[model samples]
Target: MIRTKIISTWTILLVCGAQAGILESPNYYHDYAPTFHHYHPQPRPQPHYIHCTPEVHNVIEVIPPPVIVRVVEKRRQTAKDLLDLICRALTDMGGIASEDNPEIGARIIAKLNIEKDTATLIYAEWKDGVNYRSRRFKRQAAGEDRVKNELGDLLTKAGDVIESDKEKLSPAAQDKIDSRHERAVDDCQADVCKSHAAKRNRIKEAKAARKG
Candidate 1:
């Protein structure tokens, strides 16, 4: 019986020592346990800058307008001057005499009254036994009136031709023609009484010779 009791006591102590060792092993489990935690990096932002621009302007130039001119002209000679020139040309051509035929002079003067630079009428007068009678002759009249009328017609025609061909003649040439025409008329009418004086002298000499 004692042996049995001692063996029971030794088994009880062994069981108690195992229970204490188990209870002290809790500190080792706490020191070796894993912890729950998370770590993250934060991002930084960049700075912004502002840009500037410049403005421009344009310029233009203006111009002025042009000018215009006009011109006017006047006649060189009058119509009366042209008429006198025609009459003078006729007398120079021996178509009419300054004396003896007062009828021709009267007709010319009357015709000149109508117009200066135009053709005029010239009538023929015949001695009807004692009195002078006036008559209109056709284009074939053979008297001084016909000659004068033809010359006047010629001057009128020449004036027309000159007007048509005005560009061909220079101003100097026109002046020369005018001067020549005037000189011819003046020469025809110059020294009228000189011939009468000479005739009277010849008559006086003849009378003296007869008396001697």
Candidate 2:
């Protein structure tokens, strides 16, 4: 019985010694302990919005107006006016020489109006002879008016042509065309009378010779 009791005491002390050793060891409690983990929350997605507006349009119109035009007529020159211009042109020409003034008279001496029924335009011209040959352009009024004379019409046409062309010439050229030194008039009637007298004398001489 004492041996069994001693053996029991020894077994109890061994068990206590093993328990204390386990407590004092370094890795013994750590190896048998439970583990813990921690986590943080993440941010949520944001809400989105979009705004819209309407489109607008505009329209316009254009217009135009009408136009008008008018024309006017020109008046004709009268006989009296034409005759005055002719007279002025004749006065400007100083003498009568065909070479100096070939288109018209060399010189217009004078215009005579007799009793308002007859008109004579006397001008100097060069004929076949060496000297100036005097001539006349006479016209009787168709009725009572001297302005209706045919000579006036002829002269007026010539004056108009000259006047129109004068615009194209130099002033000096125009002056030369219009004027010359004054000269004497060689009358056509004196020449005609002289010829008649000479013819009569020849006829008398022939009659005398026939009788002999």
Candidate 3:
């Protein structure tokens, strides 16, 4: 009976020791009941960019300047110069305009007036047609000094070309040369008249056409 009691006590002590060891163990729960562990890797950190460079594109354009030129005009000649030119032209044409000439038959009819850049001469002549027709001459030439020089040269040339010494002869000997010069002056006047008349007629006709 005693041996049976001893065996029972020893069994009870063994049971208590096993229960304390389980409570004091570090991995008691894991050792008691093992579970599955699902490990998930952490996401890697992403890099940040500042994007300091701008996308804007600006274009600049430059324009060129303009060029300018200046022009100068010539001065107009004086009226006195024009008047002198007319006298010079008449002299060049070998017609005498001397108011002092005693021989009135050799004198040309001249009307002197001041014009632009030159002188004006109005010459009248009697043309013998069915009756005596009157005509006017317009003489155009340069300035005073130029006209005088040109006319003098022309007169000298005329005297040489005609080969007649009228000034050295008596009045009877100079009759032909003097008459010829007078007739030339008269013819020149007649021509001027015809031209002026034609111009007047043309101008009148143009006016009539414009009116029409």
Candidate 4:
């Protein structure tokens, strides 16, 4: 009986030891179930509310310089050049520059009237040469009103061409042309008279010789 009782005690102690070994085991208890934790799902981050305006990446306003258009240059002309142009305009009007000048004085000289914006035009030939008048001496003065009027027309035409107006010529301009025409005609007549006097003197000398 005592042996059976001892065997029963030993069997109970062995069962208890086996249970304790299973609970304290590193591989089964510690490694498998270290800590029992409850995991609750976290809410996602809400995006920050921003203003409607788009963000400017660059500090300076990124705009290219405005396209600059170049202006066209206008033609430049001087007053004297304008007068020469007017002379050309005159030639186109079927008027000879100087009637007395078969070819002597074709060129002109110009004076400016700044107050009236007018040009005084005269042929170069009129100003030269001297005049000697005696009772028998007669020199035709250069005063061709017809040529003056034609020059006036030319001046008017040129004015219209430049300013698109017929009132372009001032009174001063007309006076200048008139005076020039008169001078040119007088010079031509004087030269003619001188030639005639030379011929008359030669004839008189021949007549006296014949009488002697």
lDDT winner between candidates 2 and 4: 4
What is the C-alpha lDDT profile of model 2 across 157-189, one tens digit per residue? 333334554444556645564432111011111
Q: Please, what is the TM-score per model?
A: 0.20, 0.21, 0.17, 0.18
lDDT of 3 by residue, 26-117 (tens): 54432333422232223344569875445433444667677667777645433333334445543432333232332431332221112111
Badly placed stretches (over 4 Å) of model 1 are 1-142, 182-212
Question: Model 4: which ten-residue window has the lowest total lDDT?
Answer: 108-117
lDDT assessment of candidate 2: 0.39
Q: Total clashing residue pairs per candidate?
A: 0, 5, 5, 4
TM-score of 3: 0.17
lDDT, candidate 3, at 84? 43
* lDDT per residue (tens digit) for residues 1-212 in model 4: 99999999998888768756655654443223343233222344456996654545445676999999999874543233434544443442212323323222133211112211333334222223214363322332333333333334335333223232212334444444444433332222233423544664689799999999
Comparison by TM-score, 1 against 3, better one: 1
List RMSD in Å for every model shown: 39.2, 40.5, 32.4, 31.5
Minimal lDDT window, size 10, model 3? 121-130
Compute the lDDT of residue 34 as modeled in candidate 1: 48
Quick one: how many clashes does candidate 2 have? 5
